[model samples]
Target: MNIDTIELKQQQLTYPQLRKTQQYLMPARLTGNSGQPNGYDIYPVAPLGAGKIFTGFDTLADYIIKTKAVLIDGFGGVFWDKVQQQLQSCFNDKDLSVNWIYTETFLKPTGEIDALVKPFLGADDSVWGTKATFDLIDLFEPAIEQQVPDAKFDINIVIGTGAALAGWASPIIYLDVPKNEIQFRMRARSITNLGNAKVAEPFQMYKRFYFVDWVLLNQHKKNILNRIAVMADAQWPETINWMYQQDLEAGLDQLSRSVLRVRPWFEPGAWGGQWMKEHIDGLNKDVVNLAWSFELIVPENGLVFESDGNLLEVSFDTIMFSNNQHILGKHAARFGDEFPIRFDFLDTYKGGNLSIQCHPALNYIQENFGENITQDETYYILDCDDNANVYLGFQEDIDPSDFRLALEESQETGKAIDIEEYVQIHNAKKHDLFLIPNGTVHSAGAGNLVLEISATPYIFTFKMYDWVRLDLDGKPRPINIEHAFNNLDFSRKGDKVQQELISKPQVIESAPGYQLVHLPTHADHFYDVHRLEFDSSVTVNTDNTCHVLMLVEGQTILLQTADGTQKQFAYAETFVVPAAAGSYKLTNTGSGRAKVIKAFLK
Candidate 1:
């Protein structure tokens, strides 16, 4: 099918109307007396009665004046100019003399930074970069110690990305911007990379940010998290909302031992679908199609906390930095600060097929990309049309060299090849689980809503073909034939696809009203999946591993943790029960049987 025909078909296809549930989009953990989850922009944090939270610049400036010296360190993409402007306005009439220090002044030269990051930024690839190992302090000059004045003014302030490196034993105010907001600012050309003075193209900038800037800044943030006196939400240009570090710690502690949900974000893509757009109530309907929902990708997601009526958000890593052992439990020793599992949605309903792709093997990823884990994925079909199909494995008589030549010719000549001749196709049905370990070729075909559960090191897909369609920007997506060729497992073809790649569900435990069915993942997978089908309620033990669950087959279910706190989750809503929670009970709140898919490290 051509692009125009696909577009017309997407517009004309009629979808089955599902019940619209608004709570799943912006799910939040209500702390203290907080009643509701704040809307999409602002999250809510309940007061812990520890350090005081400052709302406006005047109050923040008042707190600043009380201290002899203050350091403002934060994540990348913060509008430092706007921050300085607002603070200067707040301090204009004060009798105190202010001395300002910007950490950027002590940064290494641009050429030096570019050279330092060259190895991590792969050659001319807009989509990938190797994770860097350097710290934020390495980017700054050693003379930063001499920059801080010995003679203190009434108010001495140091601010910027690495301001904490100034070594001032002063109150630290950390400004945080969510990952989604950072990308928005990058797209608007309002923010540059950490040490750069000029903004580059959004795609290139994001590559650098992911591999270099964010890596270094997150380490810095983690190192100084305990020292921070206040955490500021600097997403707004003119105003700032901040909470006490002790309060944030309280929230993080609560999250570590309790059930929580990271806020999910949605994005549109060229091969996007109408499933999420029509079914998810709070999503913006103006977009052409919603392709992916970052359901529980903790690396890019944020946890929101509510206090009184005000809301504040911090990156998901903050929880890991604070309570890794509590959140991860037995897995903490191996994974450390990294949350090893990810769950997201791949919506191809009424859209196009995903690009034919395979992920790198564990050794290849570790040696080439410096990643600790590989992207071994599984596609659990949540919903699908009757004609839905999944492209997987390979044809029985596939020839590697001929397939490579055909792919290269398609890339050069813009001619489509018969993909089915070289690859295998399987009809997809709802609730069918397909294993896609590293080196397995697969794609979610059209008319399927796939819930992808996998390792956390995402963005390592090597696309072999893309059906000759241009992206939303009217540009061809990058093809990674060489990378795919190196990783693809030619042995996983023909009958082996059906015998091993397809998961078989078996009832492992059953009661009168509840049954726990094991959806056996591949032997290479480090995690396992179980489906809890209950007519009334079922209790589950954590078994000393974290549980990532989604309500897949029911309208709603109420989760009661061991701590006696209960929360309700709707269909397709993803939530996490920390390993410290011990055990939890799920009650089917709707009329039908509730099926919740739970993934835990095995």
Candidate 2:
């Protein structure tokens, strides 16, 4: 491609739909509990892809020459198909022919091409006379044979289903550079399991507990795949016959019995000699030498690089699973197909009683000339100190400007708020439930361990105040005063949260546990809070409903597998079990009382 031609074509490639779609996804307004609706409230699921929407036109073709750029950030179907059809019609003119670009950040193909083209097309690369796009011949045909190793191929495919959109095709594409040669790294996409770790406990260990939901790693010119194979058998817990009930336990327990102490993750020696034989030791030695290892692997946040010396390579992209449209709230894409929304349970080690500041209302933020805000949070106070004081909402009506001044002062002077202005501060107790509507200023006071259930996943935090914890760089983080000020409403004072116990709230003998309405939404906002307490083992048959089981007080075994096979979790630990776990048992194994919170859409 000539630079002169690129400059000329750049101006002609104007994508109008791109601009419109970007605006459509950006969260433009905030929403409140019971207030006037704001005009700018845009609750787009994923707004980061707001910039890449566009289409490519052929410019010259006889019939309805169809070539278009379908930019899908996450999951797209009827909505996108309708948009694609409209674009096809728009570019069907005699003078203009349509060409599809299909631009998508989350899409593996787009990311791969972008990653490959970036280095060669980069300004620094021009000094070496490298071009932007290379043909297949140039990409694979190595300059030397002895320097490179054998290449291995891996492919994974799955069907995507959605409510608003059905039959949406989304597939994972993975390509690994040949091993046993000088290489940068290996990359993969949408990988379900990589049996790289050592799993010795079998049924006694927890599966997918590490939170490494996705992986992309790099190794030197060694059989990295073979290393991975050794790691897999030792890491993941698969099913097998068990003579006793203990055989149905997690593998971690089995390993713990041998090791005497339970460890968080695998120890280096746990890989054993079998794993060491597969060049694992040699690869480990070589990995530290690489200058740069790029694995466009999507972890929690984004891209990461691991190296084992030799040459350097780059990955295409990385995406967090929570943000992954296909598996956002579902156990997996298959379960998500049946249930669109994914209900997640978060156990913040430090977010117990000393909670952060509250967010603003959607209407106030949108109308009052401020940034977009989404604030709807609920908490199940599983445990709290006897004298713990949880402050929430305002005590009395106040001038909005005064509240603004208070926020400004907090931002400038490190003060949270004018303590005098706080509305209803209550001493929160254990087993209490609270509904925090948008715009209400509240925090989970210190020493209060709780289960938080919220509306959306995005973090629209307005730091009213902090315990004054300095950042790693030793700087006080700036607060968004203007936005937080607009959200605070002094008129409505929220009430204390109490467990709704109607003696034996309507019992569902068919269902496992009884639903004790702790805090009703009252106004159908986000979710209905409930406390599920049972003495005997309860059978919960999941029908596409994912649950975040948090053991507050005692140990409970989540019987997931068919028959009696299950994984046991103790207090303070939380598990996001898939609805596919099907009908499982929640057996109490601890000595004392067992308390847990069950949050789902009713």
Candidate 3:
């Protein structure tokens, strides 16, 4: 992804100004005001096993009145009141009592678990080792098996909050929430400090553990959603659409075009960059640096569907739940219905460098993080200052034990380790493709806006060193030397690092109007990347596999499908074409040459 964008001297609109403009242009929101809710009509995004999804208050009430046990699992921050009220209505309908087994009942008092292992354990491990916190089987199974009493009720509903995965009940209802929304609720509602009952020295411990909890919660949600019969958007008091996989497939068949873009969520971080804050319209600039744009992490991403010009947003998982053959194709066994690739922004432009980190190996990640896949990432430099560089691998020949000791000592003492003595630094240029497979140590240096494309396991980074920098909250970030050591492949050091990890582009295919440059990925990588240089337009085959694209260099362009349906994209704007969408054309409607990067499962 080439990010050598000409700095436009256009007036910078304030967040409100951009928002007002966007609101005026956009149609009526599909969210808010549940007017004649068409939800529950199609849900679970796909079919679960062979059983039918029994929904509607009356239907559930009738089932519950006669049923033995049921389990409903979701994030606690989502609509507890609405859930309770609706369940009560169902019980009131037949004058039948119901059993509610909330997993919160079994939580250990606060401070019982020291989750403050690291302030920045990447995305996955930061959520604490939840397995060590509590035993799911021991705490929330008896009730699931009907051994525990149901408060003298006819039916039992076990509300498993990441406490248990295999609930002893048929048809688990999994409620999914975008991660940004969860954090938003965390701030709006001062309910952090979860699982902590006893007093502690620092209040920020809860906040520190919050990220880890978010990570763990998401892992549990994703895993549980896999076995669920029905999936619902957890946004309560709003139109939570019921998604069914079969319906999603049928729905796609009907649409001539599907604009695939997740509602991007922004957050300020200690090492947040200024590029997004300055360039991305409608973003609040008054806050600290803009660090992360949760572009398309499905478990943390929601999809917006337009119905009669009403933009209703649902979980992105629904797209996968649809189980469209075109999306995954031959990779269906590996990724199943879940989308396998993730596209996000890592802005270090005029900001601090990302923590030196490496992801766990495949089997190691599965065992430790509960993710079947690992994060094999690539940084396509989108926009960068002339003096930008990326840190990768280890320098020369350093003692692994000494490196570990230095990192541990840095964590103990506030003394910053000389990072260069350990990690290799490479100059970063616009469109430079840096491959970071699993167990590879890497960090994007300052002054570079990076388009981070990788496998869908967004979390699970084991941050080894943080340059002794404190987080925005004035707290020291985490350093997971132990976990990093376990995952780090020492072979990804010295000269071999450049030879193998850094991608070199070569013209793979070309024509009069277009040229495709292959940005060769590592052999272990299951995905491929390419740069499409086009003058007017270039057509490409989806080959029954989904494609994620970004207008890295162009000012603007149109992505048109075979049906002539067009969606305009601008500089740095990312979008996906589903496998079922088949063939599409990218028309470079912008001035000058347009450079776009396309990534898909290999």
**Which candidate comes out best when scored by lDDT?**
1
Candidate 2 lDDT, tens digit per residue, 1-602?
A: 00122332332233222211111111112122312111111110111112111112121111123311111211111123333454355454433443332322122343353355344322321111122223322222122111211123111111111110111222111122111010101111111212222222211111221111111122110112211110100000111000111221222222111110111111111001121112111122211121111110011111111111111111111111112222123434432212222222222223332334666576653343222334466655555556555667665554667766666676567655545465456666665656666766676565454455555422355666655555323555445565566666555553322321101123334344433334455352444544455665665654554454455555543444433444555454434444434456677665655666554544
| Candidate 2: 10-residue stretch with minimal lDDT | 229-238
- Candidate 3 C-alpha lDDT tens digits along 180-240: 5545445444234345443232324333444455445544555554466545555434234
Model 3 misses residue 443 by how many Å? 1.1
| lDDT (10s digit) by residue, model 1, range 1-602 | 00122332332232112111111222212223333321222232323443344567788898898886899889998889889888887788786678999999999999998889888988766478789988888889997756665465777899888888988888899999878778877876778897788988778998999999989988989899889999988865656778878888978888788788887878888899999887864455767888998898888998876554455678999999999998999999999999999999999999999999999999999988889999999999999999999999999999999999999999999999999999999999999999999999999999999999999988899999999999987999899999999999999999999999999999999988888999999998999999999999998899889999999897888889999878777788888999999999999988889899999999
Runs of candidate 3 exceeding 4 Å displacement: 1-76, 82-126, 130-176, 187-259
Ranking by TM-score: 1, 3, 2
State the lDDT at 445 in candidate 1: 98
| Residue 68 shift from truth in candidate 1, angstroms | 3.1
In the order shown, what is each candidate's alpha-carbon RMSD?
6.8, 22.2, 8.9
What TM-score does structure 3 among the candidates reach? 0.72
Question: Against the correct fold, how does model 2 do in TM-score?
Answer: 0.43
* Model 3 clash tally, residue pairs: 19
Q: Which candidate, 1 or 3, has the higher lDDT? A: 1
Please identify which of the two predictions, 1 or 2, would achieve the higher lDDT against the true structure.
1
Could you estimate the TM-score for every candidate?
0.92, 0.43, 0.72
